[model samples]
Target: METIFGLDLPTWWFLVVGGVFTGYAILDGFDLGAGALHLFFKKEESRRIALNAIGPVWDGNEVWLVIGGGALFAGFPVVYATVFSAFYELFMLFLVLLIFRAISIEFRSKEPMAWWRQLWDVSYSVSSIMLALSLGLVLGNIIQGLPIDDQFIYRGTVGDFFNPFSILMAITTLSLFMMHGAIYLVMKTENRLYAKLTVLVKNTTIFFVLMFALSTVYTLLYLPHMVERFKEVPMMFFFPVLTILAVANITRQITKRKYRFAFFSSAFVTAMLMALVAVGLFPNIVLSTIDPQFHIDIHNGSSTDKSLKIMLTFAVIGVPLVGLYTGFVFWTFRGKVKLDETSY
Candidate 1:
């Protein structure tokens, strides 16, 4: 048990993996949110403006996902293998939808025909919605505990992943993303589109608040285990409290027409929510519903201490470089999106 700042190596790696995925969710979430709201912008110019709003950086945002996945595989191979195997079909579908979503962004403006653009618009919106929902479903199922046996093998069917709790989580994820995206769009547009998006931002905010409230009530009633950590360690309660404040500030900033602040608030809300998940599932990467003995935790699920030590060195150097690059890209593309002949 090599210690780093009072915590074990595996715990540090868990934090690393969680931080990377949280970055992915916050960065990529807005684009997916924008895509999910694509069809709502009916007019060609409005849709194109929306598409261009995310065009310069959507692909770059996915780099965090790749990093997160790699970190997961490196740090927690057992949890990776078990979860991926358990949700093989769902992951495959998620992959296909990801491909379609990427292609829709690239190919939507290739032709002048209404039918062609309309086809890709539907594909884009549907793929974005499903992608967000699928992520939520996976998170919900993971938090709720999986049916894993003693060997760390999942024994549940694919159908088991579609339970009511998971569905509620999926909807909540979608709504949150939608609200996040609308805020980003509002920040990146002006005039009529900006005004329209302000209205949308409010609506999406309401939608997310409703879904979040329902999810909160459902979890408190049915998944009481989630709150046990906060109860045991009262300090951990700050994350949820900060999350509520961030959610509240989203509306406050939006109402004040400070969309940049609103967008940052949304991103903070995203980070805090993920932090809540990490806090709730600390130590245990995957919980087994069948038996506590089957639970895969940081210690059992992680690689050798030496491996983590070596990879941690690389991560220290590499992750900051990725962050710098991401920051540079966003800085370069700062301000309103203007449609041009070369725009997508």
Candidate 2:
């Protein structure tokens, strides 16, 4: 019941968690995207450059995910337990992929054998793509709602996460991250590889735009209530509008061969789109399709007010520290990725 600038503590913590995921999506997203497009770089050196482009930062990028997961468990224990139990299989696969993805990168350069390199490359790319898809599937299932019972328990099986809408979202998310990763790679390469990616960027742009458009139409047609928040708050409509403009800017920057700007625009587009999702799902961390009464909202799902306030205090001090470290690392490694003996 306590308010911070008129918003309650649980709501504030929701924003914190959402913000952490947004950071994760933008940071780890590029690396995952880079890995998705990894196999496309045919030449060995090309692949190394691509890997090294993300090498300094991929693991660090995952730090946000760790933080986000912790925040979810801390702030919404019930929702976390229900969703995890329901999506157990996918989560298990996701965990395996995460481990493999890291090992793939680490072991790819351990041996110079063609078979060794090929094996790890396959593992890395597959894990990255699957990781991105898994994330999208989870979000899509959340948006579409689960069969949560009155006790805030998920009454569905693991297979339920694979519903058609979730599949569409997985593909769309892959395309989006592919494009995002390609842009980041472009920023970190030059000469022949850069030329190839100039073309790749254009193609990925078209791919993402097509998939995104199709997803939008499908959501509007079948999942129209996603627009409910926008309808309720006319001002909220501008979020999508700005996202559109940012999308346009992506093409414009890519065409101008200004990849850094294009990368920024792509990152912005991600943040804005995620903001839309956060807005659409505000208050309800997990929706219940069977009955609204069974929904796990911020109020019902959150820790006690005293707990939230204490968590918020740590979050207030902790988030900016994470943000600062993230910025410092990126700045330290800024500019084109140069290969060396240590490169992977």
* Candidate achieving the largest lDDT: 1
lDDT of 2 by residue, 150-232 (tens): 88777887778889889988988898899999999999999999999988899999999998898888888898668888889
Using all chains and alpha carbons, the TM-scores for the candidates as numbered come to 0.99, 0.98
Per-residue error (Å), model 2, residue 110: 1.0
Question: Clash pairs of candidate 1?
Answer: none
Tell me, what's the RMSD of every candidate?
A: 0.7, 1.0
What TM-score quantifies how close candidate 1 is to the native fold? 0.99
Query: Once superposed on the true structure, which residue ranges of model 2 sit more than 4 Å away at CA?
Result: none
**Cα deviation of 273, candidate 1, in Å:** 0.6
Taken over the whole model, the C-alpha lDDT of each candidate is 0.94, 0.91
